[model samples]
Target chain A: MTAERSRLNLRDLLSETAVALTARPARTVLTALGTILGVGALVTTLGLAKTAGNQIVSRFNELEATEVVVSAQSTGFGDNTRSLNVIPWDAQSRLERLNGVTAAGTVSAVDVGDDLARSVPVVDPQGQTEFQIPVMAASPGLFGAVRASLFTGRYFDQGHEDRADPVAVLGPAAAQRLNVTRVDNLPVIFVGDEAFAVVGILADTARRPDLLGAIIIPNQAARDRFELGGVESVEIDVAVGAAELIGAQAPTALAPNNPDQLRVAVPPSPRRVRSDVEGDVNALFLALGGVSLLVGAIGIANVTLVSVLERTGEIGLRRALGATRRHIALQFLTESVALGALAGVLGTSLGVLAVVAVSATREWSPVLDSWLPFAAPVLGAVIGLVAGTYPAWKASSTEPIAALRGVA
Target chain B: MRSLRRSRGAPTPDDLDDGPLEAWAVPTAPAGGLSFEGEAVPVVVLHQAGRTFAGPPPVEALKPTDLVIERGEYVAIVGPSGSGKSTLLHLLGLLDTPTAGSYHLDGIDTVTLSEPERAGVRAARIGFVFQAFHLLAHRSIVENVMLADLYRPGGRDRRRERAVEALVSVGLEHRLDATPATLSGGERQRVAVARALVSEPSLLLADEPTGNLDTATGDQIMALFDDLHGQGLTLAVITHDRSVAARAGRVVGLRDGEVIEDRLVGSGMR
Candidate 1:
C-alpha cells in the first residue's frame, strides 16, 4: 500500500466552507448574531469605562482635592472644664486673604433647642410630618464653596450680615416642610415665635449635603437671636494642587495668636478615588461582557453541531475523495473561525458608532483604548476556535462507509 | 497541465511507474487478465473477501467470497436485495474494509493498509460514481469536477483546465457553470461521471449508475459507459438490472451473500 503524506488544500477547503455557510444563509446569520451582540457589548463596556473613568478623575481632581475643612479643637480643662477655641467671625475674610485660598466661609451651628420652624403662627401638636429642622449660619460665599444651586431669590449678603437683619435662606427640604415654595411672596417662617424673612432656597449641595435639610441664617443674625456661642468651623476652597499649602497655613490664618488650637482636614487624593472607581466599574462591566461571550460561544457550538449533523453526506463524500479526519476537522474549524472574525469586524463598528453617538449627545469626549478594535477580532476568533472543536471532532469521526450508505 | 509529483515515502506500484497522467492515455483493448504487453496483473483481486456487520449478534453480510477483476475488463456484479452486492462494491471501491480475507487493488495489498494510506490509494487509482449522482448542489458542474484535484500531491494550478477536459470527455462541457439543481437527471449523472474521471483512476467503480434514471435515460447512460469502455477504460458497474448487466464483458452474480454464478455475458445462455 502506498503510504502517502497527506496535506489539506487551503483554497479548496475555503471554497467548500464558503459554500457550506451560504447554503443555509438564515442559519448562518442567526448564528452570527449572537457573536455580534457579545462582541459589541464587550467593546462598548470597555470604551465607556475609559470615558466615564476619565470624566470622574478629571471632575474630582480639581475641586475635591483642593477643598480643606478647618474645625475648632476642644482643649481639655482640669476637672471637666471644657475650653474650646472659638473661630473669629471675620475668619472667612482672613482665610480668603491667603495666597492659595479661592473661597472661604465661617460655619457655625445654631442651637435650635427643640424649636420647630413653621410658616404659620402656632405649631399644632397633632400635625403630620412635624419639622424639627437643624439651623446653621454661614457667610454668603458658602453657596460657591459648597457648589449649591439656588431655587429662588438670593443668598444673604455682607450688607445683611453687617446690619444683623433677620434674613434667612431655607434648604429645599426645609422649605418643603414649612410649605414655603415662593420667596417672591415675601415668605416668612417663625422660628419658635421669632420671625425671619426668607431670601433664598438651596436646591442641592455636593460638599455639604446636611445643609439640604437645614435652615441657613447670616452669622450676625444667628449671634443676635440664638446667642450663637462661637464660630464652629471654616470651609475653605483653594486652587488646584494648593490644598496642602492652604491646610498648613489655614490654622495660622484663622487664629494668628494660637494656631495650634485649630485642626485642619484635607480631602482625599484624587488618584486614590480614581483608581477605586475604575476598579469597581471595570469589574462590573467585565462580568457582563464575559456572560455575553459565554452565551455567544454556546450559540456557535450549537449551530456548528447542527451543521455537522446536516452535512453527513458531504463529509462522507469528502472522505471517499481521500480526505483524512484531520482535513475534515480543519475545514469545519476554519469555517467557525471565519464566522467569528466576521462578527468581530461588524460588532466593533457598531460599538464604536454607539459610543460616538451617545458621547456626542451627552457632550462627552469618547475615550477608548487604541488597541481594542484590533484585539477584539482575535479574541472572537479564539472563542470560535474553542467552540468549534467538539463539532469538528464529531464531523471528522463519522464512519466513511456508514456515511456513504445514506448517499446510495 | 502541471507534471504530477510522487508522494515522498509511498511505495510506487508497477503500473503507476508510467504515472497517473500517462495511465489515462494508455489503451486497454486486449481484454481479460493481460494488458497490451501480455502482463497478467489484475487490477483487483480478492481472496475469500467478506464483510460481517458488527451487531448484537454478528451478521455476515458477505460470506467468504473470492473474485478477480483484470485490467481492461468490463465487469458487472449483479444481485437482489440483501445479496451483498453493495457490500462487495464498497470493499472493491476501498470505501470499506473486509471483515475476512485479503484484497489487492492495482498490485497493492489493501487489507492491512492504514486509513490515510487507503485514502491515498483511493485518490490516486480509484474513482466512484454513485447512484444518486452526489454533486454538491451549491457548486457549479466544473467546481464539482474540480473536487478531485484538491487532494492531488502538488498545488493544482490547472484544475479548471483539467475539470473542463473531464467534463468535455463526458459531453457536459456545455453545462460547465450550471448548478446541479438546474440539471436533468441524465445530465447530473454525466456530471458525476466527469467528477469521477477527473482523477484519471486505473479502476472506475459505479454503484447503480443509472438507478435513478428513466429507461431511456438509463439506456443513454449505458451508451456513455459503452463509449468509455470502448476507449479502453476499465469499468465495474454494480447493478440489479439485467439490462445493465447485459452490456458488461463478464458478469458475477450473487445470492444470499454468496457468488452463485460467474460467467461471460452471452456464454451463460449459449
Candidate 2:
C-alpha cells in the first residue's frame, strides 16, 4: 500500500465510527445526554466556583498584597473571630507617619444609611433621569492606600476634615447614577435637608472593578452624621521593606512566634452570622454540583454499555476489519469526548447567559472574575473520557466471531 | 478393494529389489504410476486432527483426520447433516482449534498460530461462503464484497475495484449499490461467492452454497462455481445436493465423520 493510503486510514476509521453512531442518532444522543448534562453541570459549576473563589482571593489581594492588617479587641462580648476590629485611627495615623512607612487607612462599613439618599435629576433628550447613591466614610489617606485616584476633581485634605464641609467624592457608580457630565461642578441632593457638591470622581480599575452607587466622605465629617463607636473592618500597610523588621520589634509580652490572625471574641455577631450563611449557601451548591457530576458518570456508563450491546454486530464488523482492541476503545473514547465538549461549550454559554439574565433583572453588575473561561471545557472533556473508558473497554474485548453470531 | 491403504512414507515397489517380494505385489514397476508434479509443498496437511466439544458427553465434531490437498486442485468435501463437513472446513479455514492435530496450512503449521495470526491466515489464505449468505445487512453489495479485503494489504479504492471485478465475474456488476436483501436468493448467493472470491484466497470453502435455492437457481450458482474452478481456482463446495456434488472433478463424501466415498463424477449426474 502507498503511504498516502496508510496515513488516510485513520480518518476513514473515524468517519466510519461517526457514521455508525449517526445511523442511530436518537439512541446515541439519548445515551450521551446524561454524560453531557452531568459533565455540563460539573464544568459549569466548577466555572462558577472558580469565579467565586478567585473573587474572594482578589478581595483579599484587594486589601494590599504586601501589607498585614492589624486588628484590636472587640468593642463588646460578641464579634467574628476572623473579623479585624478597630485598630485605633490615631494609632493607625501615627504608624503611617512612622519612618519608611507608606500610607495607611481605617475602613468604616456603611451600616443602613437613614434616608440620606443621593438624589440627582438627570436630563436627557427623551426625559429626566433620577437615581440615588448610598453614602460611606473612610479615614484620611484611604484613597492613597486603596489607590483610588481622582479623574476630574481632587480628594479631601485635612482642611475639609477640620471644617466638616458638606462635600463628597463620587464613585463611578454614583457619577453614572447622577447622569452627570463631570463631578467637578455637579450638585447632588443628599437626605431631606441638604445637597452636596461632588469634589472628586473615582476612576474605574480592575482591582475593584464593578461600581455601586455611593458617596465617600471624610472620616471627621462622617463622625458628626453617624456614630463611629464600633470599628467594623480595618486595613493597614507596611513600608516597602519594613514588614520583617517591624514584626521583630513587637513587644515580647505578646508572643512573637504565634500567628497574628487572632480573633479573640467568644461569640460571633450578626454580621459574622450573615457571612457564615453566605458561606453555607456556597457550600451547599458546590456539594450538589459534585453529586451531579457523579450521577453524570453513572449515566455515561449506562449509555455506553447499552450502546455497545446494541451495536454488537457493528463491533464485530469493525473487529473483523483488522481493528485492534485499542482502536475500538480509542474510537468510543473519542466519541465521548466530542459529545462532552459539545455539551460543555453549550453549558458554559447557558451558564453565562443565566448569570447575565440575573444581572439584567437585578440591575446588579455581577463580577465575572478572571480564570473561568479556560478551565470549563477541559474539565468537561476529561470527565467524558474517564466515564466512557470502561464501556469502551468492554466493547473492545468482545470476540469477533461470536459477535458475528450475535451471541453474548 | 484397496481398503483405505495408508503408508507413512511412500509405500513403493522398490522394497522388492532387495527383500522378499511377497510382502508387496509388483511384477514390473509400471512407468510412473500415480505421480504428482510441481511443488510438493503440502499446501494443507492434517496429522491426526481431532476436535471434541465438551457438551452432552463430549461430542467429537472432528476425528483424527489425516488429510492433504495439493496447491492447485479443486477438491469437494461431500457430507450429510452433522457429518463434520462444516467442522472440517473450519479447521482447514483456520477458524477453529484442533484438540489434537498438526494442521499445516500452506507450509505453516496452524497449531502454533496466535488468534490474530490464525485470523490473518483465514483472511489471506482461505475464503468461506455460508448457506444463508451471511452478508452484512447494513452495507451495499459492493461494500459487502469489499469488506473481505478492506483491512488486507490494499487501499480502499483498490479494494473496491477488486470487489467490483469479483462481482462482475458473478454477473452482479449492475447491482453493486443494491443491498443483499434487495437481491434474489440466487443473486445473493452469487454475491456471497463474489465476496469469497474478492480476497483471492488459495482455497475457497463454501458451506451449502445452493442448498437454499430452487433447482435452476441452484444449478446457476453451481455453474458459476464450475466457471471459477475452470479459471484454476481451487474450490471446496460442501453440500448434500447431488447435482452440485456432481459438478466437481473429485468428490470426497463423508458419512458419520469418516470418508465413505471418493469418486469422480460425470456431467450426466447434474
Question: Number of the top candidate by lDDT?
Answer: 1
Model 1 steric clash pairs: none
Cα displacement (Å) at residue B249, model 2: 2.7
TM-score of chain A of each: 0.53, 0.48
For model 1 the local lDDT of residue B39 reads: 54
- lDDT value, residue A138 of candidate 2: 64
lDDT of 1 by residue, A1-408 (tens): 244534567777898778877877888878978787888888888887777777777776565787898989866677553336457889888888899888888777788787888785456668753468889999877777787889988998999999999989988999999888889988888788778999999878867888988899999999889988788888888888788889999898778888888888987667676677678777887888788888888999999999888778778878877788888899999999988887787778888888788788878889989999998888788888988999999999988767766753
**Per-model DockQ against the true two-chain complex:** 0.28, 0.08
Residue runs of model 1 more than 4 Å from their true location after superposition: A1-3, A60-271, A279-285, B1-40, B266-270
lDDT at position B106, candidate 2: 60
Per-chain TM-score of candidate 1, chain B: 0.86
- Candidate 1 CAPRI grade: acceptable
Question: In candidate 2, what are the lDDT values of residues B144-255, reduced to their tens digit?
Answer: 8877764443335467777888888788878999987789999998888888777566678887788778989988988887777665566777888777777887788887
